[model samples]
Target: MNRSIDIFDTTLRDGTQGEKVAFSAEDKLRIARQLDAFGINYIEGGWPGSNPRDMEFFELAADASFEHARIVAFGSTCRAGASPEEDRNLRLLVEAGTSVVCIFGKSWLLHVEKALQITAGQNLEIIRDSVGFLKQHGKEVIYDAEHFFDGYKSDPEYALSTLKAAEEAGADTVVLCDTNGGTLPHEISEIVAEVHKRVDIPVGIHAHNDCELGVANAMAAVRSGCTHVQGTVNGYGERCGNTNLCSLIPNLQLKQDYECIPDEKLEELTALSRFVSELANLNPDIRQPYVGRSAFAHKGGIHVSAVMKNEDTYEHVPPSRVGNSRRVLVSDLSGRSNISYKAEQLGIKLDKYGDNVSEIVQKLKELENKGYQFEAAEASFELLVKRMTGVWEEFFKLEGFRIIVEKNVSGSSRTEATLRIKVNDQAEHCAAEGNGPVHALDKALRKALHKFYPEISNMHLNDYKVRVLNEKDGTGADVRVLIDSAEHGKSWGTVGVSHNIIDASWQALTDSFGYYLAQKQKSIQQKEVI
Candidate 1:
């Protein structure tokens, strides 16, 4: 019989140790509910004794009910020369109101001698007493043997003695930690197997990613009879990181035939990964395995062609299995297959047998050579196709535009823009002041077009990026601008390139407005047909 693996997530605890990772009390509570809904066995909330924020999280979590996961309080073993009852850290663990308590004890003699300034015997007593204290309080205890692998390598008898102490003290699980994260996969497999032979209780693994081997080491431990695995989402932790449950879960359930989460909940992997990244205010790693945006994205001409015929030709697994979709990118290297696929995805009609496909490919290459990247600026690509095929209708024509900057003695500056445009043979002119030249220009253009197309108010620019294309030319170098626009819960990107920054911004800005108008028209037309 294949036994299930227990997933203990430390994203709220150890994950926060990573640089730039932080979560509020509400954020931690929200994440705990998400993890429970996704079928995580245990969620390590935070150390209640460490900070007010962690204590606030436990207080908030006490009122919130989890459907599946048990909230765990994490702390270290009692300090040397102190009993568990007198230890403030242990006292906080009980008062945190969590059903499970996890505490780490020193396994390395070097730490025992130098860090704690205690003998090896005293360190063992700390581990034994800490676990026994939590058990006596009617709590399930998970004893973490900090630096177990390093300790085992130096003193095998002493390391095993640490696990024996926790076991004798009634630890529910003894987790072997590669605390320094320097252990190899073979060593992990051998050491865990040796521990499993000596220990009667379930063995666990908590590997770090300092060597980028956290997932590999965890997998090796499982293969050697470890039933519990501890990790953080996206491999988030101090130094490099901890074992990435995002990568390890799918690998375990799909490749190793070991159950980590419910098979049906597996489809939520991608969204969960992205959700956590958003909460942590971190950009999602597009190239991350299993759930990243670029994990199933195809770019090459040959790759797209083959993928069209058979996704299995290029993709390792079906993207749908992980709640991610396959993306076909179009660029200078795009073939007819690339454009045709993109056209379908964007709901654009094209004749596959006609010359439009080849024409668009050539035009894409020419534009890209001029520093227009269509891969990320699909809105601009769509407009290009529509114009090339004579299917695009003009929204407005720009007659002229002017900008003025004024400065005062206090180092403050004011920018104003004036623009004129003709819509359906009617001319409109407007002026506007703004914090920046681009903002002033955008406002002036919108004011001029508002009467003709009031729906333009719904679209707003959210992100703007400028890249210098010809750095060799210095200030005279051509620059490309990419603008991200959002409307009615949807977003799109447009690109422009010119020697002048204002001109480039204008081009991208106009394309952003044009794409929104075109999409709105298409939606209205579709509704009429229906």
Candidate 2:
């Protein structure tokens, strides 16, 4: 068997099935170029003849050139009792003009009888004719045996015959799919072993994550001699999701000694994952396996100390290997090493054993114990450290603020905010109204600050999320607010905690403005020196 596994990405096809996941033809084309740039083996454009966007994408991709990844057009086999030459779906696959085509056919006897209302033998004939038609047209056909595992368990003989029909019709590879995503990894290994014994064609695995076993089962298939793997970029698909190629590529190359994607391309995994999620208009799940933001976050004091001495003490692999960096999360649980690490990143030199490090650690612990979380709000954490170090300078000071919520004529609540602040010891008061209190505060604060610092007008508040800490207190619980802020083209997250929602949002909003101004000033100073 070939040691090199082929990575087949169906993000444009299957990934679009995910709820809230939609992509236009241009979006699909942009993603295809990125996948090819990263050296994916096969990029499944979409299922042609199903949607206009997919058909347009296939038409546009006909003239596009890919350096490493082959653009594959996907469709199902000819309909039951229909001739291959007359099947519209099969025709779309060939009209796509791609060198390779993937055609899925009924493997489960239940699906064949109930869904297609056809006899098992008739299903096999369509599989045979579909593969034969594509091959005769000079297209390399990959047969997807959909629901193969469930089919084998129900009727092993009937399932094997479907694959045999495709192989006889010149299909080069037969991909086994856990269509219902209910089979276990051990079951996948057993079924794949059985299939390899019955068919001479190479095997592949396409799995879903309903049981959270997509990656595990795909790995099991590889161990059982399958040479091709199918998945999406960030595990985007229907139900639970598809196998995450961001996690799969590293497992095959770094851990399993299999050459799947190139090393340099593998390093771009983190960026690629973020790009896809960004295009989907969804926030990245920072806890995802290899490419997540919090994948290597350290919170325990002992763990931080051990990691500083030797990263292997806590890390499974060098995070930089996949373009992700280790993060030292400072909280009430952190130690001196955590403080030292964060300070280093901030470009603030602190002696590892100095009083400054000890003081900062103790202060952080005290504040965190009082409900100040710095992990998600590094900007506020930096400001705290600067204050403790006595190097902090205030750009502005809040005199006071007020917000009023009243019913409008339409019975909807309207929020009005008044902000008073002093910059250079000069007082400025501003007022604004919004649909909500937080929005009112955001507008009022920026209005007051923009007078002193016009550059702050470039800052935009992106996302605001709130979590109640003491739910036992019910409506009186303390709330934690996390704000994602963007300036120019860069973005960062900051956090705040308070009993009042307005107070929590105000603190986070202030920290966001503070961070934005500080970064802007640093850039200007750097340019002057340059």
lDDT of each: 0.93, 0.90
lDDT tens readout by residue for model 1, 316-340 = 8899888889988888888988888
| Best prediction by TM-score | 1
- Cα-lDDT of candidate 2: 0.90
Model 1's TM-score against the true structure = 0.97
In model 1, how large is the Cα lDDT of residue 202?
91
In model 1, residue pairs whose N, Cα or C atoms come closer than 3 Å (at least 3 residues apart or on different chains), thus clashing, are none
Per-residue lDDT value at 10 in model 2: 97
Clash counts for the predictions, in order: 0, 0
| Tens digit of per-residue lDDT, candidate 2, span 34-56 | 99999899999998889899989
TM-scores for all candidates: the values are: 0.97, 0.94
Candidate 1 segments whose C-alpha is farther than 4 A from its true place: none
